[model samples]
Target: MPEATWTYLMDMDGVLVHEEHLIPGADELLAELTGTGTPFLVLTNNSIYTPRDLRARLLRTGLDVPEESIWTSALATAKFLDDQRPGGSAFVIGEAGLTTALHEVGYILTDRDPDYVVLGETRTYSFTSITRAIRLIEQGARFIATNPDATGPSREGSLPATGSVAALIQQASGHAPYFVGKPNPLMMRSALNRLGAHSETTLMIGDRMDTDVRSGLEAGLKTILVMTGISAADTAEHFPYRPSRVIDSVAALVGSTDKPFG
Candidate 1:
């Protein structure tokens, strides 16, 4: 029997590039995918930058990913809101990526009696904005967050992310936000939908067992846990579930894209 053609959903930060540096074999794998016209999306939970911004950054590292091929938690959140309540209004606390997505989806960004209080990643979280979000949620607006990642990596150290801010708002307003990013399975499903790919023929490659592998497993896709990111070599045994396979990095799968698991 001929091997099934595989579609790829890949995590960006640790798997492709780490701290602005391209990982070994990243360019080669991407070139192969593009050359063959295989469907793929570069996925990220970070909501700070738009896809154009991310594409430029990747280009700086010599990776030629197209802007439209990047999928973000911000985009997923916007899509969810658009589906749940089309043409709704939201008071969003995020950067360009989040705001741009909401705008594209025709959501009205406002602070006056909005229908939802959306929280996303921002380098600087303002107490004033957070206070306003809490008040809006208290006023009966639903709470929604892009991702549940509590901390983000930084050169200095770990920085508090969207999930941390969501926790604070939940404590003050007694309302927990519905996270739409990885580990939720919603993110994986959304990416699959965007690629027009089915879970059975798709492969999810990531460096984290918690977010990437967990989400892919739940979404019924084959998951590959790479050792180049947050999860250490021995990390998989601690998780209740296991990935479909584990590898050193994307470099190992360069020539084996047709049958990654085999």
Candidate 2:
């Protein structure tokens, strides 16, 4: 496919930036995409921040991604809920990102016998909230989580993410959550739908084989794995599946945006 015709779905944290530092050539690639008028969305499984918030954060890192160019798991989850049960209420255990998306979707935030118990990323995982979520799930509230990421990266180290807490909730309530983020093709399909792009013509870029590459592959988009984040050079070999291309970083693709992939 001609590169000019290729739309893109890119992972945010590892592929673009790492904890407030811009990956080399990330800005250039985005500039090229924007300059060429290519359709692209910066995707993130982290539901902690809304697109607006993320855009601001990225701008701070010297990456000028527009708010509309960002897509979060929170938004994807909200979209799913809106489609499944419009105007439904959810007992949420998350911050503004998750809450704002749900709100925008006409979903009510409530703890009183809601239609679903929605979970997302939070810096502080409250014991009280988790207990309430468990009880609510046991009381017949359907369980939903923004993402299934077990851990998230931090300057300090790895921190427990939504998936880990979801496991605890499932153990207590005997109900597993339906994860709505990366590694789930639902996330990728929803993104493509949002971008108004076809999977066949879109490219997915990320650093992880487990989530990014896997989801892109499942969604039938060409996947490119970069070495700028969690995955090492040999990480793809351990995976049952492989990315369409593996490069050192987004840096390598700087001038090749218009070149056809072989």
Candidate 3:
């Protein structure tokens, strides 16, 4: 609010929208940030769709988030692998989002003793694919998952996500996966780096305490918990770590005088 001194890294699903519906005042918050030339990114753990795909979806929902402002777990996972093992091969169990990211990094997608067994978000989690991933991991492939989100929100209801499938693979293969999404500070750090924003001067807005708030805290960014999504205000106290600020929604921050997390 105070001349956009603090940059922002916000969660996409909960903070901005929920299951294809734009949250109240979400568009105004983005508009305000863009109008003031505030550096910001809309981050999401869902790796099922590419940035272009997501931007199209958001536009259909009446939230005009820029394609460049969107960052997905697929991109982060690709970046992580590139940094760790450049041009490495992976046996990916995901959709176009994950496969495309890996390809952009010059990584090969194969099942022939791949360097990593990459897991990501998908609507349909095939048992055959999970079995293949488990077998690959058992044969000494490192397990890498996009996120640890056990459940995903949908118009119908909650659906099993990457984390739930990751758990099953871990149980079978006896190998834990390195998650590259929310709740992991690395993801937050990557977003900060992309924005050229220092952690001390950035604020993270999210609705989930376990993923967004926790990751922001660990990444040394001030976190604000909004009650427009998954984590209710009452549930915030249940977590050991707390957000720097708690508000009813992003609507409250629109044109407010308070300069939070500066």
Candidate 4:
């Protein structure tokens, strides 16, 4: 095993790139570690893109990650729903990214009395849609959400993410959903399994305290919080919890030779 036998779980957006533009040193850093056969995976909450889609996009951007190295909330949600209802139809409120993943995994997407209603971050979220999903839940449909992140990264500022939509639905339906993204043990389990990572030798890094950071801490892995993403500089000001290591960006982790064996 390598000195840093630690498997690193990296978040996709903000941490790796903003939109389609790659961060300055992200590609090089990724290449170096991958060349050394260091184990790592891109654990993303964006259910908009498939593993194969993301793999090819990353390759074009100069990072050579394979399909297995990319895990998304879409995949986790699909797996969870597959276990709950095989070939089930889901009423969705997200992007094509999520619907594509569900479709690929054998889920039948529908809105006519669906078996489950999966909500996500959709630019087109509205009262009508929320009411429809809420009605379905009230009528005994299972509820699922991609992630509970309330805010997302954007040039203008933080926009309402899945959390906002989820909160609304939960408010109306009087029932919380089964979230399948960060901080959820199911996602952590799937990620670790795919990476062949042991909690004793893995690191989870991200920018959100409630989701990414909290999830990493819960997974019994060393956690690093970076300021390059959603969490601002003074984010920890009112917070009691802190990550194991605080860095300005993923660049700080680029070539650190420290292993996680301790």
- In order, what lDDT does every prediction score? 0.95, 0.93, 0.91, 0.81
Tens digit of per-residue lDDT, candidate 1, span 106-209: 99999999999999999989999999999999999999999999999899999999999999999999999999999889999999988889999998999898
If both were scored by lDDT, which would come out higher, candidate 1 or candidate 2?
1
The number of the candidate with the highest TM-score is 1
Q: Where does candidate 4 have its weakest 10-residue lDDT segment?
A: 253-262
Tens-place lDDT per residue, model 2, 143-177, is 99999999988789999999999999999899999
Structural RMSD, model 3 = 2.0
Location of the lowest summed lDDT over 10 successive residues in candidate 3: 253-262
Scored against the true structure, residue 151 in model 1 reaches a CA lDDT of: 95
Q: Which should have the higher lDDT, number 2 or number 4?
A: 2
lDDT of 4: 0.81
**Per-residue accuracy of model 4 over 4-95 as CA lDDT, tens digit each:** 46678888777787676776667766776787788888888887677888888887766777887888998888878887788999999888
Better of 3 and 4 by TM-score: 3
As for model 1, its CA RMSD to the true structure in angstroms is: 0.8
Could you estimate the TM-score for every candidate?
0.98, 0.97, 0.95, 0.86
Ranking under TM-score, best-scoring first? 1, 2, 3, 4
Clash count for candidate 1 is 0
Q: What is the lDDT of residue 159 in candidate 4?
A: 86
Report how far off residue 98 is in candidate 1 (Å): 0.3
Off by over 4 Å in 4: 1-4, 55-64, 126-128, 232-237, 257-262
Higher-ranked by TM-score: 1 or 3: 1
